[model samples]
Target: MPSSRISEEITFRKLEALLAFMETGNLAKAAEALEVSTVSVHRALHSLEEGMRCALFRHEGRNLLPTEAAHVLADVARDVLKSMAEGIRETREAAGYSADQLKIGSLYSLTIRTVPQVVIGIKTRRPDLQAELVLGSNADLLYKLKQGAIDAALTGMPEPDPEIESIPLFEDDIFFAAPADSRFARMEAIDLRLCRDEPFVSLGEGFVTSSGFMEAFRIADFTPNIVMKVGDIFSLMNLVGGGIGYTLLPGRVRDMAAGNIALIPLTAEFDMKQTIGLSFLRRRERDPNLLALAAVCRMTRIAR
Candidate 1:
């Protein structure tokens, strides 16, 4: 089809409904947000299909899901929408309003160290802008990013998500931490296999740290004896310090002096290093706050 024909056929209302469906992942919710009845939302979506000359939603029971075509067009819609938002924000800036506030999310371990340092630097450079930091497990953070709930995030590389463009910031080595009175405390670098039988405390399952720790052990051909599970890095360290069990933690935990705890490097002949980075939707790359955040991250060093 010609570009002129496509443009003439497309209506803003239909595009809005399509994007809302993509965001809500359901017709009823999208309808509520659009302040229209479910039937109206459904009609708009069906008309959108006719205009595009392609099927958008794949019907499965009561649910309408994005087909491959819908997935492709959804990206285009997001780009269009983001451009519109940027235009509006530029207008607001020109009218003497501060730049739109940036919402950032962080993994728990980073909340204790890296994120604060970066936020301090960010505020110093752009004192007029507002910044909010949210802390959660990597899974939760990534979910919020997909939903447009946050502007950007500092997290361990969760996985290769095509929607998210990641800037590599640092590589954090996982070390076994234990209290001085514990059996594994005096070790310099221990083989991961030797520690498989040792009771360990670790981050909860949804956390990236837990995933990385398990992946390291799986590659080394063993399952860990995880004795306890905790949500944050500080608690994991405190547990290890109190001799609950050994735990795998990043180098940042070393910043504090805990009397009985030691961080022992792993001697496994595999990549046990956790890659830490900032991530944002690829479509949001041009947003001023996101671009500025990426710039700040670029100035920092990544541990090898």
Candidate 2:
């Protein structure tokens, strides 16, 4: 249809005035209801009637009487206005702007302490709020944050990125982890060179711990013998506990497994630290929901 033929002059404000006038059946009352001057109300209805290209009112003596066409348009306008408001509200919520629920992504290890503390603190502060935890590796979590699949992320902070906003919560040292019954458990600290020939079960490619594991060995000038690679942290920890092979882990997992696992410190030369942080899109830095989450993060730092 041509734009000229369509009611291009029709607008929500006109529809609102039409509804008010239709409800009150008085020009002064409609103006008062809309918090506008009587002249504004008259102009709105006049434009609406002209846009509709029909007789919406008829003058009877000194008063204006609404025609049946006006009543029909009022009913439809009411529905349209209500639906528009609902659409805007739902759109905001779908974009993670809702205060009723928060979607938080994190490294699987942080679920042991840091993630839980932040979740609890935020919930306590916002009593009506609900939280969802999405656990993955560091790479996985940061990818989700960028994709807007999660509202915030708790993971090992990456080197500075322009698009991401990172709030460093704490530094968690990487430890040389092995079975409790292993001979290395009795040692004061782990020397990576001694374990170069030792078979290792590692958290696979995308994990932050996996990168730290590789870096420590690289600093020690040796390549670790790889026995297996797993997706999640828990599985790697289980492998270590079952005497499968030695692996590296962050301090957050120190007490996660039973006494079967021992977390020994790394030698000075092989020292590596994973900085855990809360991260989101830099554009959403001032969002109320994100600000509240940041506040909780500020107070919920987990001690290694």
Candidate 3:
């Protein structure tokens, strides 16, 4: 494949005209949006097509229909423009050009339970620290932390990496949750063998909780017959609420009970608990802001 021409060598003014043309679908509207004459917009797009050596649009009445090449180029151009806007925003934020804000990332499961508590605790301890919370999956949060998009994050025990360091905050055990009217709900403690034949609802493979639950089941020497594989704790709990199937969820869920699902402790061969912790890049250890955030994480715990 041939290397593309340098962005500087190509005129961004023509690219902007093409983007405006795509959005408005008509020369008059495109010219209005670009704040230029209809003749100017037409000339810019014609010149852009000349540079690219392709027909970008087809004329039908007053409307212009994008060709396949135009469609593909428009997608890339949209992303490029969006990223440029984001870069400008982030640069402004980092240059002390706006109100200072601390970015934080946390797992979706903890967004309702552990995260709010930590935010309140941070405010009480450091009233001046302006904070912005970003909720994502463990992998997504880890990626953000590594990229310096987030100063610190709260998640379950993430697999170790040389650049990342995890500090233990709390241990959260898994328990069986079932509808109050279900047969399993009557039991205070559930045996793994007894639940082997029961219908199971659980998180799928992408989540940390599901990964741990699968390993625990294997270690306990039982293959669970999962009837439904959901994405988040809320949906899994809802499935349990409707008595779809019993599910194993982290003890942190005790903090946010939305339904009449019985929480049963498990005394099986393998003990399952997700070690909730704070993760940050090892290089950021000495940073004062991150250090203070780490201290705040240590003081916060799952509500009993």
| Best prediction by TM-score | 2
The candidate scoring highest on lDDT is: 2
Query: Which 10-residue window in model 2 sums to the lowest lDDT?
Result: 295-304
What's the C-alpha lDDT at position 222 in model 2? 84
Write candidate 3's Cα lDDT for 191-224 as tens digits. 7777778888888675778887788678768888
lDDT of 3 at 87: 90
Candidate 2 local lDDT, 23-109, one digit each (tens): 998999999999999999999989988899899999999798899999899889999999998998888787777557888998888
User: For each candidate, C-alpha RMSD in Å?
Assistant: 17.1, 3.9, 16.3
lDDT of 1: 0.79
lDDT at 285, model 2: 86
Descending-TM-score candidate ranking:
2, 1, 3
| Alpha-carbon deviation at 179 in model 3, angstroms | 1.1
Worst 10 residues of 1 by lDDT: 92-101
- lDDT order, best first, reads 2, 1, 3
Root-mean-square deviation of Cα positions for candidate 3 versus the true structure, in angstroms: 16.3
